[model samples]
Target: MDLDTGVALSRHDDHVDPFPVRRAEPAHAVPAGRMGYDLGAERLLLHTVQSAEAFESLLTTGTLRPDPELAEEAFTDAYEWIHRMMAARLPTRGEGALWFWARTRRKHLVDTCRRSRGRVLLTCRVPRERVLLSHFDEWHLVLNKGLGMPRLPGESEDDAFARWEEEHDDFDARLRAAGMRDAPVRDWPADLRTEIEKSWESIFDRGNYGPFECWQGTTHALNNDEVLEAVRII
Candidate 1:
């Protein structure tokens, strides 16, 4: 595949040290989104509802409310969990774009949640221009820091790098066959890196998105027990 991948990933020895510890300085700004799951910071939870009535009930109880502008859109009776992902590596726009994207996700997330009417988990794998999920399905997939390709399964890190370095002959051919795209890329800000990694949390932090916010004044617990998470048998 003649594809340019997203962000430079950090690859440690997947078997020996899958989760290495590195301390990042606190975010320079007051943190616009959730930190990465690897960090101990809180994760945002949401109570997805299907109608204005259900949504308004939560508001009355001071639980949750849809963004007024966003809520103007009609919702349906379908109920499902939509696992949507957002990427916010806005190098050109800087912090302003981060806040803008975060807030946008907050509104759009409810729209996705509202259309879910089954036991399906609707997931959107996003634009490749930004650094996408790392260690998503398996930790074994390591980006050869030097070569930037997935290390072959069971290959030692050294061997992977060696193979990756020597394989430029048919690299682009293989990448295109694997459905990769040729795209320009840039690095994310160190401070916003964690937030983008867990950008899903931003959907519940509507208050941080804009001055005219509608989230109830509460930090929701990190589970579905208190949430209106819906499911249906297939």
Candidate 2:
């Protein structure tokens, strides 16, 4: 299968239209690439979503939140609920399927973790070494999907790199269409870091958020400065 087909299917349109744009269907409901280890014919199936209202509701106003210590537990509860919801319609028995949600600059990411009950695998912007690896049972892996390039199965490493380079411009254009006007850090002045810190602090003060700590991925590594540059240009 063409990699672009899969890549296109994986990503959501980031562009913001002035008109009231009706939200598209959830990504998890659609067919996606299979993940996890396969045992003979017994392959582990998976799905991913940028957002899940069902999962979000369980954590936000549910009985799952009893105290600040149960923050991770709440996240785990949401994760499990999402898994079961997806697994019921999927072929796999939910033994080992993967699901992920990302938060680009949302400050509440950490508070979300603090109020959760179970473990949450947060992908944040900080370095991996700074994080407590023991909190998560499995160490997170970095998935490098360049620009608009879709992820394909069985593609050669060389081909994937070539595709990333060729499609980067398209990806950049797509980002521009989104409300993101400038690159992440370049757009920020010396005084703006204070605002970023305050945003994080506000979320920490409130116990109604989730964890989304930034760290280094094994496959692709980008420093904070580099990441900011890329986002700004987009």
Candidate 3:
């Protein structure tokens, strides 16, 4: 199979399967230490919202690479930070990774359409091995370099910060106290940064954190052949 185009290169005959054969029911939970669905037979039906220009590019090139221009203009440094974390945690599907929602939410689609002006919803069936599923809420913590330390049930934000400060070293405490606003991860100690990066791997655990929903996935790239459907939404 062509990794870039996600299409089988060899021809057995004139006929070919339009979609991957469903080997079994989807797994209920992703196993530990395995970010991708490599161990399972399930293929995920993922959805992503992209601008009209991105859709056109997919149509023309038969593949969709990450848009650096869009990231620079809209996401600023958050995009870089998230991709960097992905590089460390999910090395195979790290570079030029494209975002998708495992479960489509109408609100997110509507908001993205409003921001991009002319956007489309792309739905595709991707082999589990080609994707990394993660919790959408915990991902923000990775981007913002926030405290990944689990909080007690009744703990307030201030209380959690205080508890985290007590558990870690002075530098770690100070950085946490400073928050990402004043002290971004760029200036953090090398060891502390690695520790934080390690913590970010938990984003793939699919467990609920706070009130945010967990429905995000990332793939290295998507090809025109893999796209099951596309709907204009602007």
How does each model score on TM-score? 0.19, 0.21, 0.63
Question: What's the lDDT of the predicted structure labeled candidate 1?
Answer: 0.27
**Candidate 2 — which residues are off by over 4 angstroms?**
1-38, 42-156, 181-234
Q: Write the per-residue lDDT of candidate 2 for residues 1-234, one digit (tens) a residue.
A: 124322122122653211111121222122233222111122112111212333233233431111223224424422333334334433334232222222122233333433442332212232332111111211110011122232356777689668756665554465566534354422434344233323222211112222433211111111222111000000
- For candidate 2, the 10 contiguous residues with the lowest summed lDDT are 225-234
Q: Write the per-residue lDDT of candidate 1 for residues 1-234, one digit (tens) a residue.
A: 111322112323342211111211122111235411211113222222234343334424533322324311121100000112221331111111110111123434434434543322211111223211222111111111012345455778799667756764354454445443232111323333233224333333323233333332111111122332222112
- Given candidate 3, what's the lDDT at residue 159? 96
Q: Put down candidate 3 lDDT per residue, 1-234, tens digits, no spaces.
A: 555533444335564444331111112111124233222337787778777788768766778888655554333445666676567655465355698877534555445545543466676777776777777766676655555666567778799779867755554565666563355566666677677766666666643244335467777788877887565543
Q: Between the candidate structures 1 and 3, which one is better when assessed by lDDT?
A: 3
The numbered model that scores best in lDDT is 3
Decide which is better by TM-score, 1 or 2.
2
Could you list the CA RMSD of all candidates, in the order they appear?
Answer: 23.1, 23.6, 9.8
lDDT of each: 0.27, 0.27, 0.60
Deviation from native of the Cα of residue 153 in model 2, angstroms: 9.2
